[model samples]
Target chain A: MAAVNFDKVVKSFGAFTAVHGLDLAIDEGEFVSLLGPSGCGKTTTLRMLAGLEFPTSGEISIGDRVVNDLAPGERDIAMVFQSYALYPHMTVAQNIAYPLKKRGVPKSERGAMVQKTAELLQLTELLSRKPRQLSGGQQQRVALGRALVRDPKVFLLDEPLSNLDAKLRGYMRVELVELHRRLGRTMVYVTHDQLEAMTMSDRIAVMEGGRLQQFAPPTEVYRAPANRFVAGFIGTPAMNLIDGEIRQSGGTWQFHAPGLTLDCPPLLDSARPGPACLGIRPEGVVFGSGPIEGVVQVVEQTGHENIVVARIGADMRLTGRVGAERVWQAGETVRCGIDIDRAHIFAAGAAGERLNRPGLRPVEAPAVIKAAR
Target chain B: MIRRVAFNLFAWGIVLAVAFPLFWMLVTSVKPQFELFRRPPTFLPETWTLEHYIRLIQDTPFLTYFKNSIILSTATTLVVVAISTLGAYSLVRFKYRGRESLAFLVLFTYLLPSVVLIIPLYLMLVSMGLSNTIFSLVIAYTTFALPYALWLLRSFMAGIPEDLESAALVDGASRMGAFVDVILPQLLPGIISTALFTFILSWNEYLYALVLVNSDSARPLTTGVMNMLVSSFNIEWSLLMAASVMMSVPLIIVFAFLQSYLTRGFGAGGVKG
Candidate 1:
């Protein structure tokens, strides 16, 4: 119902800084995910917005009012913790009605609201049971029901589905997206799982070392990551990164490494060619026959697709995805074609900013190059 | 099978060894005065008599002593549990300097023996003009019970996740509301166990009761029963046994009522379950 904004928020515990100069603005009814690896300050950022943690400096606001000094109760936010922190003594109905009761809602109205919320969560049959009597998924639903029944201005979920089984996680992911659609409340979800952030978030904020790395849509993050960390962290088998130098070969500029060489994209024509990192997605490394030849080190079948890890030389290893029908074996000499137009190029050192290429728009094209005979 | 049998035998031996004193007290309370003085002690009385019980009720102020013990123990348990709960909550939830050392200091107090401090405590009470009063016994009992009560409840409070209370706070409840609505309920088993422990400690306490109170009207059952042996030249063994049995009945009932909670794992299903 309200936009949440963090303006240069920094959090530290004693001498250790957990979040550093964070600035983010979540629009009304937006489902934004704060995604990062563990200890990356994603949860700390969410807790600061929830008023559970006070920022060491800077301001956080929900709607137009700055909430830096407000208590969590005064912020009118509901949070579903990763542990599904349900009151063990209260039954499912009572758990759902707790927020309403705390707000001093009358008995009859609270009862009606509890019934409605439980029915929405498909927990009507389990209302009489305590949290201990319910299944893991049921306990999760009850936690969700408790947060939802209050109908707060913003919903904060900290890896809520991480406790469930794999199958249940998948089910809950869809259900959560659907719930967000129905409610259309500003929700800030914190998770380390990239798939969850990719599948559910309208915009994902990828973080590293207590700082925001990239904030963009899922496709933009996948097709055009802002930095090397986002490039490596956002994908499944992860993007293959090769450290090499760009040098003038014959007349055109070419990237050269241990056992690889490819024409540099025209985007680098203006810069003095030095050291750069080449990033290629698994799908971008087509594995039929092309310029790059390597021995397949390992092949893993994931039912839907095959992931082939190939070593091109003494030092470089690249993974490529192929159709399930194309059987690959270890030690097999396989040639792969790198999608040069779709590949990402970054500076060699720590702050690896992406180098923009003129011909490459953030659009999917089957620009498959054939092997040289 | 042989090892299992040996283990069972060893366990039953310990149980019998512990139960023998209570068994002897019950049987001796019902024995007639002549049987109590018999050379070969009777495990089972030849003739059970109600004369000792009748004498205890009619001759002595045994009822008044029993009533005073109940009031003192109940008051001590209530005060100890309330003070310890708040103290334990502050110790567990807040992050201040010396928090760990403060908890350590409370545990250190429990290590000090009551007999070591009884003389100074008695002198202080006399100077304060609090001697021979039931209120003095209550105050002494609470001081003895508080350290252990705080230590027990502090550990129990530590097992409860802070997330439960944080969730409550975000659900529109104030800090105190979260403590009362979320934490207090989960602490039920721990509180029950602490109350039972303090109650039993106060009830069976003889040292403090002996030093703090002397008047029959203010004396607890423990000291009052000891006074009986001194009042008569010939010790009435049957009457003493009857009084001992009566004093232990309330303790047995309280233990039986709260035994399950006392031994249960607090916060079992609060998090993952």
Candidate 2:
């Protein structure tokens, strides 16, 4: 098992940059995710690591060796693509044994390995069946099994669960987390889904527009987002972001969003009275309580959970999650307050460049990050 | 439903029309000579005899021509498959300068009419001391078969999703390894059809064989069977029919073996979107 390092690695397709100077040091045996939206260069980054695509600039090293020009086979990494990409013509046994065979392993050892791996993945019964014969989840397992047979130094998976049904995806997610824990191999997973990143990664590298926006522990990144993008990108109902000037009102600060206002938390209150964006997760938006009121415009009941969308101002709408058993109708005005202590404030222009809480010295009282001017 | 039925009938009608000559050849081979010339053209004989079949064995160099055709066609097909699969793989999978130009060149080679080139080829063959030789015939046959094989197999190779091969590469196989292990097995239908196509093209080729081979040693069945009518002067209709029937047997057997793949291989369900 080896740690993979990307030192200012950059990839460009002609004039358009796909991955711009991405620097990451993935620890050995760590489960890390390169999470982003589509076209945000997550797959491109993974491909570069796998040696499928060479970076346009900088170096990529697997462990101690700089293998920027090495072939994919020389990299000792296995990737399971978004599509399972199982060989349609081969049986599950043949597909899983492909890499071992390619490596010129002895026939006896290879067969034994295939059998052992199949049994491990619960694929023994389906060994003779082709990929098309298997369900999507089973095919995905086979794809993983195929990679696992290689016993590569690093495991690279590009949204392997993205194609499965939600229920199956969740089940597979749990299985994967267990597998990662069991194997303890250096694994770099790429996905657009933040839940997958949050639940699976030892560390999450949030990205946008070919740039690494934030790379930190899941809880660290979620609770203390590096930017507004990470703050909005992570949470379920999304973080409610109201950007306006922090006007001094009655010697206390209030975040002003046109007719809307939020009492500043102590951490935010002490920060310079400047233009800021208040970040509150939908769960952090307390409803039926504070000064702000809105008519319920729409209610989406997702079994066991629901989203209550309320029209706060002439055009502004805020969404809050409630239990499916809780009944709330449209056109009824409801009061909602900000969960003040949980509210995060960021400088107006630097809302996308978050303040690092790790560097801030803790205080006996609540502390705020004085972001670089 | 009405349109589908009409289409099926029309398709079967065309198939039957194309197959009539071989069916007629088989029927006439078993009939007496007098019945062959009879009016209304009896497709089946009132009395069948093995007389022609017996005669064909003793008559001419039919066996020699059969052996020649087999050697030339099989060699040509094998060579065509090897060359075309490689050419098609490179043309379909790799990106390089002159890729389009190289593809156009292959198509141009494929489209080069044998009739237009046969005379010049014969002249070159004679100058090179290759006339009336089985080796020259195999070369000519490969020239004719390679282009279509290349073009068809290129499309088939391209139909395999790149993701499958890419995943294999990441799984520790090289690109070529991925192709041989993962992609080539999926191309079974294409390879089978291409082999059959080259074999049939070489087996049935006539103009070049007739033009280049004056000796009976190099003559194939097509030229051999047609010659039986003229060189003997007293036409043995039954023997000629027997020879004609014999000429078709390999094709029939090959088609039978490859018919399923041939149907599937004919451009349907190609790499679904």
For model 1 the TM-score comes to 0.94
Writing each residue's lDDT as its tens digit, candidate 1 over A239-358 gives 899999777766777787887888866554544578988888888898978988899999988777888999988888999878899899999998888988778877777558776563
Classified by CAPRI criteria, candidate 2 counts as acceptable
Per-residue lDDT for A312 in model 2?
86
Q: Write the per-residue lDDT of candidate 2 for residues A1-373, one digit (tens) a residue.
A: 3999999999998779999999999999999999988999999999999888999999999999999999888888888988778888778999899888888898889989999899889999999997777888899999999988767899999999888888888899899999899888999999988888888899999988899989999877877788888887877667787777676767777778877877765543336777788787666666778888899999877666667888888877788766677678999889987766677776677334442233243322212211111
Please write out the lDDT profile of model 1 over residues B1-273, one tens digit for every residue: 999999999999999999999899899999988888788787788998888899999999999999999999999999999999989999999889999999898888788999988888889889999989888888898888999999989988998898998989898899889989989888888899899999999999998898878898999999898897556477778898999999999998988878866566454535573
Give the alpha-carbon lDDT of every model: 0.88, 0.82
Error of 2 at B134 (Å): 3.3
Q: Note the DockQ of each predicted structure.
A: 0.65, 0.44
Per-residue error (Å), model 1, residue A97: 0.4
Error of 2 at A215 (Å): 1.0
Candidate 1: stretches off by over 4 Å = A246-254, A266-274, A349-351, A357-359, A365-373, B126-129, B230-233, B263-268, B271-273
